[model samples]
Target: MTPPHPLAPAAPPVVPHVEVPTPRVPPPSSLSLPTPRRRGRGDDALPRPQSVVPGALAALAVSGACLALTLTAPAAPALLVAIVLGVVARAAHAVPASFERGLAWVGRRVLRTGVVLLGLQLSARDVLALGPPELGVLVVTVATTFSATLWLGRRLRVGRSLTLLVATGFSICGAAAVAAMSPVADAEDDDVATAVALVTLYGSVAILVVPVVARAARLSDRTAGLWAGMSVHEVAQVVAAAGAVSAAALSVAVVAKLARVVLLAPLVTAVGVVRRRGGARSGGAAVPVVPLFVIGFLVAVAVRTVGGVPDVAVPVVHGATTLALGAAMVGLGTQVHVARLARSGGRAVLLGAVATTVAMTVSLGGLLAVGALG
Candidate 1:
């Protein structure tokens, strides 16, 4: 009907569909997947060099400081300084874990190395020179004092391990005696540490006080030396106490103390045997074996007597060993907190004081009775 409108009538022709390309998505990259780096045998084999250097430097510093103080304070006693340093280290937690681990390693593995070095300082012949009478006196005094201390420790409620350590240390040698008995007694680190501190403290006091008392009493050098060696808790203390009396006294005291140290193994073994029997009945692990360091110390003394070590090397090695021990002592001291010492330790200290007094009285009386002072 409207055929009239040619332009409108024509209408638009239908358009054909055309295909268009869609954006391509790239496949996930290999790097994008999580991959754990494998550790080669070689990679894990070596210790990180950087981590060890600091610990080495710290140990060296501690050792150097200890030596410097010893040199500078010849009159004041170096052990005191070492103890103080150890306490400080403990308080500040300044010692690195690596250094602590190293010290422990040395203490357990290379302890004999220290003992061997210490041997250059003594001889069996020197020990034997004291003769049977003096030896008898020394032996009886050590045994009696040790037994009395242990008895008192039990009565006083001191821990069993601590009591053993204190008794052995007091009766036989000082630090060496404690070290020998520590494992056998199943002493914790803290127990050994506390015992060491007590020994060190009292030893220092004896070193300073005994000579003054001896001088005032007008005792002979040999008498004073015997008294100091028998009463003091440490070899260093005996030496220091006797030296304050006189050089002659120092010589006597050191020899006497060394002789006492030689008795450590038998004494500890006896204690261990007793402990093992008791533990067996109680259904506990057997007592630990006596430490080899004590044997090493005895061997070193024998070797020195037999002329095994060189003279110059002796002093050098001795100095190094002493420094290491001092450092370790400092570490031990630092582990104790004053608060803890005050809280749980007061009773132990009291027990130690009583034991020390008993030891001193018994020793002095025995010495006088035997005419050892003359």
Candidate 2:
């Protein structure tokens, strides 16, 4: 507002006072947050030979031993035998830290590859051939078992992480489900260990129990196999359980189990959403909408369904699947620390038992209803 001399330069215009936000510098801890180890799909680095060879060799040795044992005792499933030896070794501290990386690699990568190959054995047409009723049974069984396990876990006061892990494992694909769910759920290592142990214990027992129950119930081999596939925790467990009945049953069982395996991606995504909404932090890498291997599985299924695979390749693929899966089972077996599991708490064990029963009961009941409806 002051008058200025004509010789003076014109005054600059007054600028409005605008508050600029100071860029927030995160604390050092936040800036350098350590990434949690990812066991879920898409974390596929090949470990160093020094880190991988020892455990891989050990797993191969156990797989060979299991195979030899199965020849002498046809009733014993090689997969079951492999897991048992792994559990025994783990309980005895026979597995060293050196074997950890290799075993983890085999358990995740090799196991997933086997699962992908497993799809070659299935025909989507065959699955659809079951019509809506049988398919409905599979869906109902998975949902009911998952819900029942969650309910029982709450009633038993088990930790939410453990409960979620166990529920995912039992209602889906056993140890694989536990592995997939851990990161999304922000589960602790101890919770993971306990969940894996429970799934291993009950899933192993299921290998024996399911066949016996199927026999006692006088179910047809197909029906029995379907029940096993629907109810059993792991792919290996389902194979062992259904195989104990007959070759035909084993075929049916694998197809049925794969159907349930297909549900894993969506389920994991849904759980991740629920956790995020509940203000839970992810413990590891972001959850993949669909794991790479699961996509591979679907591709394989499509190939087989379309008759793109030659007949000569069938048995070779089957043999490879068996070998890869069998080796992975050895790694799974070693994760079971019986002593640690026992010391953890009885409530977890009880929850596992209830979950197992719920899976079996719901699957069998659904199968029966399907039969009636058919």
Candidate 3:
């Protein structure tokens, strides 16, 4: 050690040079922090269009087959055939979860659209031509059949939804009426399937039964047609039954059936209003008191009445409506379980038979009362 001068700037003690590492901050672009995804109202986690294709295609295929069958056979009810195919497919477990979104879309949106188009088939002149006497008879017949079926269904201890569906179907336009009433009633698919099945079964039977009875009663062709139109559950069945008599009968019968179809819009609106009121009281999701499609249906009817859609386009409109409805039926049918239906279907069968009898009896009696059978 050397002695240091007292006041001299003593050499600074040797200090080691230490390097301080600079804090390394990465650029924002290179930072891998996850930003939260903000979902829009439309992002409700629905299936992609590609994912929905398979089910939609299947339903459309089935509808096409049904339409072909009806066109070729002239006796097959396309909607009935579609639902049967759906039921068979369901029983075989052919429907997968992936099919759900598309099937649901078909069942709801497509069905409603079809129903709106259905109104295009009728004109005010066609409905009005039935005359007050005939129209009065029509009203009475529907009311009696509907009320009796409802009472009978209650006695049979049928579920309310099934009962309502059956009552509507049997009293009005068969499967079409069932479809219309389902949403208003908030019915299960099983109920709708059962109701439709019953309508098909009994309406088919009517095709055989009505012609035989008409002959036995020595009824005129026009009278037979009127009877078939007034009482039968479906348009196809009415056609088959009336056509067995004469071409003139067929014309009368179809017009009569169209008149019945006209009542559907009002009935749905009334039921929807009632259901909406009930839902409000129960704190349930509010049902549309008058569903927009129903308004569309009325508009379609008015359009047809005013000849807004030309007669040339009638076939096209009708074909499109049938296809849409057939597709919807296929979707609804897929939801039905045969095992479950079999277990509960017996009471429905009995109700259907009784309803058929009531419809026939009331309509015939009304015709006689009004002397319209001539």
Candidate 4:
């Protein structure tokens, strides 16, 4: 068919004007792509600020709710209640990320403030009443218990921070002591909660068990009170435990408990010293010889000693202290992760038990040795 067009029309033979588009490839010079950031030495310094509201609000709400619960059940201190609520709420995953900043503020700032006010509860007059022998025994008990628990904790493979917290709480005034030391030791919220839980459980049991033992032993009211005060974890628990023995016992119990509380400053100082030494050896940033919070606590005690805070205003100050501490507890509690705590296993509990046992045995022996147990 194309034979006639071989010369003239061969080029256009049966060809149709059809267009097929090819995929476009842009020139390299015109393309713009993002280059990933190269991480460097400033990685650990000056952490970027993040949104911190949701967690903070959740913590504050938890604190308020728990504080209300304590009102209904006076046996349950609001501080302890806050910790439990925090753990439960956190495990439910109800805490939102937005509250992170608020929670951080609540945990660190409120905690330090509570420790400062804790000092107003003490006075130089009460310190004098404790006497040298009683003070010596109390100090020895705390020192021994703290050291022994740390050793036991390591052997049991408990986390280091948890071990320190449990030892402090048990050897001193339970949850209050734990909270005071949490910041000094740089402890996490869950660790503090776990330690607080341990101290509260033992302290509660002591309230019931100690009085029965005192009665069975036919101990004098003074002796019974001294025993309760030395061994019990909380001041309220101490009163309840000793009061069950006799009215006189309650008065003595309060005195003995205060002696323990006064020692908190020294204990915190000792811990800071140890940590500082360790940090120095490891070449970490210089750790302070004394924590700023401890200084504030001591100042509060000194002011009270001189009656810088008037008698008429004492109750108001006490109420404020409770509220501040209660809020801090609530803040600390919300950071707890119950499942993670459980996974940490039995060592923490065992460490707490060892501390309790040592504290009771040593303090009781001291009271008897000094003829203070009557």
Displacement of residue 253 (Cα, Å) in model 1 is: 1.6
How many collisions between residues are there in candidate 2?
A: 0
Cα lDDT tens digits for candidate 2, 230-338 = 8998776788889999998898887788788777767877887776666665535555455567667778878988997777898788667666766777886777666
Task: Give the lowest summed-lDDT range of ten residues in model 4.
Answer: 39-48
Indicate which candidate wins on TM-score.
Answer: 3
TM-scores for every candidate against the unseen true structure? 0.77, 0.70, 0.84, 0.81
Query: For model 4, what is the C-alpha lDDT against the true structure?
Result: 0.76
Question: Where in model 3 is the C-alpha error above 4 Å?
Answer: 1-48, 279-283, 372-374
Best candidate, lDDT: 3
Off-target runs (Cα >4 Å) in candidate 1 are 1-57, 75-80, 96-100, 103-116, 280-285, 310-312, 372-374
Poorly placed runs, candidate 4 (over 4 Å): 1-61, 280-284, 372-374
Q: After superposition, how far is residue 319 of candidate 2 from its true place, in Å?
A: 3.7
User: What lDDT does the true structure give each of the candidates?
Assistant: 0.69, 0.77, 0.84, 0.76
Q: Sort by lDDT, best first.
A: 3, 2, 4, 1
Give the per-residue lDDT of model 4 (tens digit) for 1-374. Answer: 44665456545567788898998877765557655444322211222234435555566666666667766886887777877776666678776666655665667677778778878888868867777887888888878888899899999999888898888887888777887777566677778878878888888888888888888878878878888888888876897798889999999888888888888888878887888878742123455667788889899999999999887887777666667766667766777776788888477777777788888889888888888443
Give the better candidate number (1 or 3) by lDDT: 3
Instruction: Write candidate 3's Cα lDDT for 1-374 as tens digits.
Output: 98877988978899999999999999866778966444322212345677667788878888988998999997788988999888888899888888867776676667778888988887988987787888898888888988898899999999988998899999889877887877777777789888988999899999998889888988877778888988999888898999988898899999888988888877777777877777632124466677678788889999999999999999899889889989988988998888888887889899999999999999888887777444
Better of 1 and 2 by lDDT: 2
lDDT of candidate 4 at residue 144, scale 0 to 100: 86
What lDDT does candidate 4 reach at residue 25? 77
Write model 1 residue lDDT over 241-272, tens digit each, in one string: 88888899888888788787777777877877
